[model samples]
Target: MRIAIVNPNTTQSMTQAAAASAGSAARSDTVLIEVTASTGVASVESHVDEAWGALSVVTEIERCEASAERPDAYVVACFGDTGVSAAREAAAGPVVGMTEAALMTASLVAHRFAVITMPKRTLRQSEQVVRNLGLEHRCTVLAVDETVAELAEGSLHLLDLFTAEGRLALDAYDAEAIVLGCAGLADLVGPLQAALGVPVIEGVAAAVTIAEGLVAQSLTTSRALTWARSSSPSEAVSA
Candidate 1:
């Protein structure tokens, strides 16, 4: 199966990070086409950015669908899941959002969850996403320490410091799961999960796995709105 992994921003580093995180989680036979948006905000830190960044993601999904090698499913590589619902309408496959995907994955293994985001802005966005997904009952907190951009371009020396903050949030909130709330933080899933003694999840990888399942099930975007209802007859007479 072919899966299109779209990093809905212009940053190459974020795209590279997302691809690396999704590597092992994808099906061995799956072909992942990593893509980046050409025109969009750099990173989504607020609702306005989240709303705006969506257009770029939808545009990329349209491009992917029109290609000969159409993706079976599409992974939107933004933690905020910008434009996911709209992309779902444009694509002939499932459109998985990182925020929804991570929460779903974490919920399967944990009773309570908390998102470890970057800075105050992202933390607020994360909370909004949780509420949007109606996961407030299952999620305990949305915590942030470092700015995701800083973490993306900054230092490996801060890993321990950041992870410790995440661990504390989990403990204090009685969270059984810790979601790394940046597509930029995708690389730290393995070590963090081990160290935290809980599922330390990355949105990028979680979205990929969910996309694979959607593909296997032959499920695509449902045309209930913009695409509208079918009006044409197939002309193949029913028996």
Candidate 2:
């Protein structure tokens, strides 16, 4: 199966990190197509940022669809699941959002899970995502005082902050598992999991695995209603 992992942010390092994590979780036969946004903010932190990032996500998917090596599935590697709806409309294959995939994966393993995101401002965005997926009852969203740029740098201090937040999720929220809520934090899964001594789910890896499974089952996004593409003017007139 061919899976395209699209990082909505313009940062190449974050895209590399997401691709590496996806590569680790994917089957040997699965081919990964890595793509970074050509235009967008450095990191998607707010509704404004997501608004800009969404365009890049759809553009990349459209570009891939026009290529000879069109992917069998696509993974939107953002905790916010940036441009997922638009990407689904633009791609011929299944599109999996990292946040949705991670939350679903967490629900399967643990009764309750917590999402730890960055920059503090995205807490509401994360919460909205959980609600949108109808997982609000089983999930909690927390924020750490770090930025996506800081996460890309990968420092021990950042690890400590994540560890502290993970413990809080376990203790205060009664969370059974931890979900890292940013694609930039993909590389921290092993370390954070070891520190928390519980399931630490990274969205990129979960999304990639889910995308591969969807392809294996020959399932693509349904274009019957919500994801239906608008017809061109000529096609509309012909109809």
Per-candidate clashes come to 0, 0
Worst 10 residues of 2 by lDDT: 227-236
Best by lDDT: 2
> What digit string (tens of lDDT, one per residue) describes model 1 on residues 102-143?
998888989888887766666666777889889898886555
Structure candidate 1, residue pairs in collision: none
What residue runs in model 2 are displaced by over 4 Å at the alpha carbon? 231-239
lDDT of 2 by residue, 148-192 (tens): 788576544578888999999999999999999888776678898
> Which 10 residues in a row give candidate 1 its minimum summed lDDT?
230-239
TM-score of every prediction relative to native: 0.87, 0.94
